[model samples]
Target: MTQEKFEHIYQRAEERKGGETQLENLIYQPLSNDDLRCITDDRWLAGFTEKVFQCGISWNVVRKKWPNFEEVFFGFKIDSLMMLSDEMWEKKAQDPRIIRHLTKVMTIPANAMMIRSARQQHDSFSEMVAEWPSESITELWDYLKKHGKRLGGNTGAYALRQMGKDTFILSSDVESYLRQTGIIDSGRTTKRAQLAANKAFNQWQQESGRSLSEISQIIAYSCGDNRVL
Candidate 1:
């Protein structure tokens, strides 16, 4: 869509609700080395693990247990997490402090190792993400799906957004809207669908001079009544 169409939709939402977009609250600045450093390693894993556990469950449930999650996770420190033994993992899978799903439980250390590997290569997970160009933010989604455990499709995108990467999250509302808008052809998440979605965001960003995060929110507002992550 053109910038005018985008603004018109967002303006209608603004008129109806009289509040700022979540993007405004997010204040997602253009990524840089400084932005990467602003979020430490522990915070990145915390965000990643939260999103991972939140994959198929009610968000409210996750929020409710988040304090206990942090406690069991030892504040998400990688060094401590990397050293957690298998027996501890199995015991924690049966623990009440966090969700007891073993698969999701295993992803914690697997992704910690993923981040550690990225840090060894680039200094930090946020830096690795920050260094990616805006023109191809979707590539990071693909990277995380391929490299990070239990982080495929929408999960990885949500993690990136939580970690403050400027990205377009294809929430249910946003994806449906994109399909209806002719940016995507079908509900199936084929490679072609992703390419089309990526193209549309790239075009919109070029036209509006807005970040992908901004464009995604505007698109959601344009088509749906409420924005979702």
Candidate 2:
């Protein structure tokens, strides 16, 4: 179907759920330090590292392994990651606590080095990212395809947005949430569900004057069939 036609269906679906809200209507809940740290890092290389490790695994699994990842990866410090020796790398690969994919495991140190090189040339990771134009969806897609090392794809791009790497929205879970909320009618192929979820979130923000955390709670309550909020 045509994009416009699809969008129309999505709008109809959204109307069935509850319709859209205004910009200032959302209730804002502050993000915790750990949560904020994911986005607010000077380079967001930590998120990149996490994405690298998350290859071929469910995010829930990666979430559980985050502590171990942090410890082994030097808190995702770019400089430290670049400094990892072959022995240290071998030890981390053998560690039972982390995902043990040999190729992905090896890519960590290599990508870290790449990140360092990029940073040296650009003076900052963010600067390197900034060089890519992220204004349009097409641009964002191209940029992601070009620069995303390892096995990351659209899903990874969405994760980067969630981690506050840039301001683009995408995620499968988020799209499911939006589909449930009746924001968008149809989902896109790549992270369409997540895009739908963010669309609903924007709408919720308009209607409730609440933050993402609050919206998350409400969505959870609604989805979980909680009678009492």
Candidate 3:
């Protein structure tokens, strides 16, 4: 199977979305490296926590409870999270202010340590994230998966997206498109599959001069039963 060019994908997405204008309006642009570097570490932690908790749960529920999450977690401040004792953590799991899942609640401190480690080594977690090259985005994914709790697979990718990182998501529609083009095989999270996806996205970026997020959106829009407006 031949891989389609970005132009073809964009054209189909535009048609599905009504027009170029409409399609562009719907695209979520990523932040520049400068802007990404300016985002505080607490925000990064918050993004990761949101995505982690959102896994296997209703995003709307999480969103509605986000203020409580911030309050209970102290805005996900790294120092505050690191200071949480075992008893405090247990109390957090049982607290009605946030979701009462112990396992998910435990990930907060672990991920906070992950962020702190990066900041300790690199001066700030934002600097590390902003300096990561988009061409090898899967490496960043791997780092988060290895170092952070429950941040593997789409969880980390979605968090990165939420934090304005330039990376592609393996959404169902994007996965279908990749499968049709033979870019990935059985599992999207496997090393081989991730590498293949990275290479393909790099090629697409070279050809189209678009961000990975834009390319991902176009691929998703092209293959799915998206509403035509």
Best by lDDT: 3
Q: Write model 3 residue lDDT over 152-186, tens digit each, in one string.
A: 98999999998899999999999888998888997
TM-score of 3: 0.97
Of the two candidates 2 and 3, the one with more favorable TM-score, higher being better, is: 3
How many clashing residue pairs are found in candidate 3?
0
lDDT of 2 by residue, 129-221 (tens): 544432333344444445555624555555445554333333454445555546566634444544554555555555555444444544433
In candidate 3, the residue pairs with backbone N, CA or C atoms under 3 Å apart (3 or more residues apart, or in different chains) clash, namely none
Worst 10 residues of 1 by lDDT: 22-31
lDDT of every predicted structure (CA atoms) = 0.77, 0.52, 0.90
State residue 219's C-alpha deviation in candidate 1, in Å. Answer: 1.2
lDDT of 3 at 136: 94
Mind giving the per-residue lDDT tens digits that candidate 1 earns over 92-143?
7788878889888888898888888896788677778878887787788888
Ranking by TM-score: 3, 1, 2
Better of 1 and 2 by lDDT: 1
For candidate 2, the clash count comes to 16
In model 1, the clashing pairs are: none
Superposed Cα deviation of residue 200, candidate 3 (Å): 0.5
